[model samples]
Target chain A: MKSNDISLPTVPFRTRGGVRVPHRKTTSTCESIVMTVPSQVSIPMQQHIGAPCKPTVKVGDIVCVGQVIGDSDQFVSAPIHATVSGKVLKIADIPMTNGAKCQAVVIASDGLQTPYSELKPPKTDTLDEFLSAVRASGLVGLGGAGFPTHVKLRVPKDKNVDTLVVNGAECEPYITTDHREFLENSENILYAIVKVKEMLNLKRVVIGIEKNKPDAIELMRNLIKKEGKSDYIAVLALKASYPQGGEKVLIEACTGRVVEMGKLPADAGCIVMNVTSLGKLAEYLKTGMPLVTKRLTIAGSAIKEPKNVIVPIGTMIKDVIEFCGGYSEEPKKILMGGPMMGIALTTDELFILKQNNAILAFNEKDARLMETTDCIRCGRCVASCPMGLMPPLISRAVKLNEIEELKSLGAMNCMECGCCSFSCPAGKYIVQTMRTAKAMIRSAK
Target chain B: MVGKLYASSSPHLRQGDTTRKIMLDVIIALLPACIASVVIFGYMSAVLIAVSVVSCVICEYICRRIMKRNNTIGDLSAVVTGILLALNYPVSLSPLIAIGGSVVAIVIVKQMFGGIGQNFVNPALTARIVLLTSFSSKMSNWTEPFAYLNKNAADAVSTATPLADGEHLTSYFDLFFGIHGGCLGETCVLAILLGGIYLVARRVITPLIPLTYMGTVAILSLCFGLDPIYQLLSGGLMLGAVFMATDYTTTPLSNLGRFVFAVGCGLLTMLIRQFGSLPEGVSFSIVIMNILVPYIEKFTRLKPKGFIKPKKESASK
Candidate 1:
């Protein structure tokens, strides 16, 4: 066996366990950006992980650019705004993957460039003023986890936060929109990071980029020198690893602190935000434009032309595909995010929400649906698991219906990072079984 | 490309290891033992092994089909069970008796409880014990190496295995090379070594179970004034340590658990051999340890994150 290609020098910064996934990045990484516009947009009222925003406008109401369509009921949620000047078609429920439907605001674009609200850049701003501007503009993390940026900036009183980590580790296989965003909007990203750090009353800030994307690193380095702010901020080269971009892992990699299990990153005196989220924040702070548009990567073998596109928040994925010259072949799987943590959509009717970063359309040839077999108890899953829990054992406990055994094996501790399932040779849906066990234990508790 | 699309949870990637692949690896590791059994115990040993494997597969198939579950006999785990049972039996055992052991292993011990990992005890060991109790004379019919008139032997002369001497010394090489015989696959030390080495190389069985188990047996036997080498080489020590006790599902979770399990297996095997009614106790010892796996995992519950340090305030207290 070849040992040279397998060893890692920075194990602590990354993880010891990750499968060698086939890289489909070459498909779209070189492609230039292509903007896509849809005839109609159906933006979901709730795209983030928190509470859904309530609709502010009912059916037949005309909504212009930057006009709030759905108002947030909670501070954690981001308000939805119209990407185009349009008349509301309906505010109805659309099917989601969770098997339930969520209310979405549907609008037909009027093909007119209409601006409802605008503001000039402030000459001098305080942290409180900037935060208020961010919250009022309805900016949220555009990097899949639509965490409200302002809320994330609100550091707890008990702990002192000194570092703000920018998550540019787009470790997922196909999605390179983050990689592209870093390359294209380096100034904005750096500015956003500085803005967030200032808001948190922190001086130390680091942009952590996976070594795989050296270009993004180079861009940040050049911009850092050009901006002459290299002392306060630096680019940390994180070893390329799956789930390296996970908040906990990123915290450990950047600041060398383990976010204790069952505790938030904020508990460890750190906050990590995605690079695109920073760019959106920068856009909001500068132009006073509400977050009504997002950058999405349209790639995979099914797409005739693979490229990154800045699309409206509610643009249909099918429209984006058509804008990219339409599909050459039917897709075996159409994922809304990256392959590792992305959700596969059964219908294109599932509009691209604010949280969506990539729309992957892989043909049948791209998918390798492995045949599942009974677990041979190899204990590889146990060894390779990042959370240090035994997946194979817990999965066995589940198979035997031994709930007590499952709990004892720490099934609940599973992060569902998919590392166990990804590395399992038995093709035993070990991750799914672990998730099932965790669910059972949770429900029982 | 156009199959029925289904939405499932994350971790779309799966490990290639399967129960069938694991069982096949075990069978491959048991190859040296099989060869030794055939060489020492004659064609009857080979015939018995074939009978066991076939019977076990058939039984597993029947059980699964009857229960309306997907047939998993193709996984070859039942074959491992069959082979392990056959290795525990004497060469002179009839095909029907071997089949009975296989049936017990697959139908009663394996499928009846839920197949593969769900079995409470090591199925093959349990089956072997059942066979020993049910067919005492046949189970104990030891065949010495080169005893039977066979094509491989230059001279034909019937003899008893070195263990049958009641208490005697034999050359270490003969025992290690498996010149003496007791059971079919248990006759040759050379074959077991080859299989064990293969399994180790493939990483199918960790060294903790076999090494610790054998070490425990050696230490215990030495304390009791028995020849440590003889105790380690005699009967089913190699076969049991390598194949039966290292069973994935029946064993505990961690290395610590495995070490404890192995030590327990070894101690029990030596105790049974020295004081109990059974002259060889590998199967019985492993079955006993299988029952303790759950408790072992419980006691060794990973120490969590804070339970170890108690946040430094406990240090002050």
Candidate 2:
């Protein structure tokens, strides 16, 4: 499966209510910064949010850069690969993002990354072969969900997908690696989109981007226009909204079709893929390399210098921090994703994964939580929530541990967009409580 | 540069809105009514408003500082409470009572209960009730609006307000245009309407509560031949429908909740007006309905999707 220049259609979609988040894009999105493989790479088996992948290779086993070290039997889990041709030093539990230890494969890099088996084009050109190839390569969604890509590509027979939506929205604040990747590797991504289309046997493909990033929109538009393929492949410029990058919201905004809650986009006759994922797919198809590296945004107010670093998957957070000139001061908190939805990592020993999009090193000021006071009943939360859920009322129920009230109030439907919390004047933790409420409701069920 | 990143609760964005801004908007929305009161009731309206606003501000400042709390009277909520309380009183009421009402609203009702958004009851309504019960004579003293005007005199005639226009209800034009005299705010229909329009346009408050409340009352009164126009233009109905009934702190949370609250306020207002001892019933009705807000919200809760669906079972299970 070499990179074939095949014609494919790009579907354009809209985005919901976006806040004007400070870009910090110039520091990271302007150029690609590739970090050298660390001397000792601590590769975690279960970096993404899913069932932990079991280690296939043990401690003291010599492994090459592309060799799979961790593979899971579960369909939802992903495998971990060695980043450098190296000797495995340890296979033990280490700190992860969720405040618990997970098994990791630690290797001492030999400074030579020659693969044990040289990567070549896929031997077969069938859909099954492509699926097997994708499974072998260990690629996930890469836009942060980290769902096994092979699983997503396997469309259910009941739902017929007419278009493949490539989400280039990159709508999250302080993250611009996807924008940079699209500008640098538009052709590669296009090839990946075509391959996806071929696999799905779909005729149309679309790329949705927010209008704020005019450069990305203009670049993609010009690239498609220059190829004289505007009809088949087009760029859609969506109005800016936070969480507009979410799969369901993006589907609704772009296609004007509401994918009912608890249903996939396929239920709405659509499949969404992030631009970075498609770019990696293109690379995998062309070079037959396993998913070993990813583009991550290293940003926040505390970092000395913020930039997008192309680091091998499983690289330690500490190493990445050093590569970014270390923290301006000891960061008050380290976050694994964007501010609105990111998980707070207690320790910086967490490893980067395909799903890890950004590492935010925020100082005390950035991590300051508003002291929740009495609910002012401003109804601002009601007005600002894109999902149309009343956050303050739901939060009240959650704080009182009223699960039934939460369920009735549609607490389960909250996308955790943080719009309610963002707009609140009483400083109540609306989203946090809603998250807890959602968890309680799900567990009760 | 090493900058201190502000760590707040979950939501970091404030939308640049503050209690002060909302209170300021409330005060601004009340401007037309204040001006109308001054024009119709002469210098008495101006003095009462000034005395009430100043007393409330001073009392709020003292209470907040004495409690070692953030002095949020700067937010102008005290000013709003002050103005609303004063507007509820008669133009003939001594400036001392207006100031006293301001103190009661700002100190006893608002600040004592935790300031701004913390009060369980509408501060203005609480103060008005307190004053009415405490000084019935002052509260109910309805005057000729401008010191017993004689028809032969050159000065403008300030007839007893619509409710007090003897047996016949005042003309629709006189009521709509604010010719009759009542309390500082209740006297002017045009002023209240203009303020409501401004509030709606600025998104300070939704039209649901005001429109629904007024619409329900007008429809019911009209059906009973109670003169919808005069009913709308009379007493505290316009002011209460536009302002006090829409108090964010005491009202329901959802659009549906607000609608229900408005409807309830309307029905209660009409029932009390037609049957109760009082000529007007807006104040008592709002207070009564405020008690049902939590229950109203509960009954009107929005059911989120997939809330009722059972989780999918694994193939192994």
Candidate 3:
């Protein structure tokens, strides 16, 4: 009998587990075209993760572009800026995509984008000055988390952060805004890396990009080489996997250091920033413009002309869909981001927030979910969970209201990456059940 | 803006796999064994398979109706159980015994425990055990291949299985090609290999359980100064390792759990066959291991990545 010759790798880097999501980056090569200014824009007071901002401009007040229309004294919140020169029409409550109502300043565009008179670059010779400028620029994590950038960059005194990790993976399916940013804004990103390294006195900076985006990786490597900072700045090509762009996963993938549970990236000696966030920071340093406009990818099954566009922050989703050549069919689902971790919009009236990197519209065929069946205990969910948690066991515990079991299963560590739900052959809502489990665990505590 | 939009949680996309597709793959993988059974046991094998499959489906439908639960026969899990039950029986067994086994498998073993994935043990294996204990004489009555074509042949001949001690050893080629008397599915080594390969390729069953189970059995047989090849080819080892032991509901959820479960199954089978009164031990070994799945899973639970176990304080005087 002839034995089959099958050789396996001796040492596999299986530190993180994630599924290979389809990279339907249709607009990767599409140059970002400026979207037509809407007749009116509605800027929500709350865009970041912390306390909601209070409206500073009342109804009928004239506001210029780059002017802060809303501000919050909270340390973890970012101010809201006007994306167009307009007259505030109303300060009514608007429904957010997450089903929360927040105060929004609705403004009528005057067709004249007047720049704010206070727009000027600030002197940043010290770290405090640099942090203040970032805060004044109204920058948040543009990778879709919407975390206040200044709060994230301010490492606590107890922990040391020596390495700066730039997240360029863009691993989600059907979103290529970051890839485009790397290709078009490589210089600005490199400049921001240099500035951040000097400001924080960091020793190394690593940019993690998935191997699927070869062009982005090559461009970043060449830029780092050209800048003569190859020793300080290295581009690491990661295996294409969903949620590789996650802060914890990216930190581990680039540095081989684990961010302990319930601990920040600073605990691992790393501060991770999104690629577009860094580029926007560099742009703000040079142009002194607040984060008022966003570059996003608009593509899905329902879209007629899926492409990349640079639109104002307060643009309604309906206007953006129209800019992409209106839906080819009735849009059955509208999502604020990529398919894996995006929030489904109940109504198209929601405005594009600062952190939204993609707006997807799916027709009936792509939107309809498969009928959920019984979990066959196939172990696929366990094998694919990036956190290494057992989704099936946690889901069962949730159904039975077993709080102790849920806690022991590490339900709180779940980042809700949707890998378990996506890989389930039975179409089980594994992530939904895990969310319920996490919520139950929290309440029990 | 156009119509009522469906709103749900995150993960708007699916990997396009369904229960029906997975069940269909299992059925496809079992075809080669089905064909081989019919070839070895003559026309009676086909009738038994059809009867078992129909009876199992009907029993599942009736059970669901009585329980007021949604019908799950469309998933074809009941059909797989039915085919597996029939394949485990001797061709000379009466049609009533086959239907009885199917009912036991679908209703008593499966649906009564809250249907497909909720069943604790492999339904087909449980049904085979029930039939074996209740109707031992009829279940053991074996017939020669093509005996139906001979008018003078008896209905059944009390023939010893290949696993029986003191029986003349069959040629390796005949054993591999399934020319001797045994259970329908366990006869052909070639056919079982083809089906096992298909299941592994379709990813319906990972090779962890099957490989570890067979490897342990082969090594133990050699250690006991028995024929390793005979031990692997005879009895229901191939069918149980490939089909029954790999049943999704009964097996553990982690690969480490499965590896331990497979090793336990192999060790128990060796102990039962060598010392116990039963000439065969595949079904017994699997049933015992199935009962220990929870403990196996608990002991072998994977420590999540980046999880740090806190230090424990020693007990002081």
TM-scores, all candidates, are 0.83, 0.83, 0.96
- The full ranking of all candidates by DockQ, starting with the best, is 3, 2, 1
List the TM values for chain B, per candidate.
Answer: 0.89, 0.89, 0.95
Per-candidate interface C-alpha RMSD? 4.0, 4.4, 1.4
Question: Candidate order by TM-score, highest to lowest?
Answer: 3, 2, 1
Ranking by lDDT: 3, 2, 1
Per residue, candidate 3 scores C-alpha lDDT tens digits across A1-445 of 1112112111213456798888889899999999988999989998999989999888888999999999999899998899999899999998898788889999899988899999988778998999999999999999988999999988888877788889998989999999999988999999999999899988888889888899998988888888799877878888888888888888777777777777788888889999999999998899999899999999999999999999999899999999989999999998999999999888888899999999999999999988987888878899888898988788889879988777777777889989999989888888889889978977865
Lowest lDDT 10-mer window, candidate 3 chain B? B308-317
Q: Each candidate: what lDDT?
A: 0.75, 0.77, 0.87
- Candidate 2 is scored at a TM of 0.83
Across A1-445, the per-residue lDDT of candidate 2 in tens digits comes to 1112224424433333345554455554448788987888888887554678888887788899888888878777667778888899998888766657778888999878777686776753888898878777788888888888888887888877777778988777788888888888998988887778877787566788877788888888888777665766667776677767878777766666666666777777788998988888788788878788888888888788888898987788889989999999768877787777777766776688778888888877766665555566888877666666778777678768887666667676778777777766666677778778889988987
- Give fnat for candidates 1, 2 and onward, in order: 0.38, 0.37, 0.68
> How does residue B65 of candidate 2 score in lDDT?
92
Candidate 1 residue A115 Cα shift, in angstroms, is: 6.4
For residues B57-103, write the lDDT of model 3, one tens digit per residue.
99999999999998899999988998899899999889998999998
Clash number for each model:
11, 27, 0
Better of 2 and 3 by lDDT: 3
Q: Write the per-residue lDDT of candidate 2 for residues B190-261, one digit (tens) a residue.
A: 999999999998778888998899899999998777878778878899899999999999998878889999
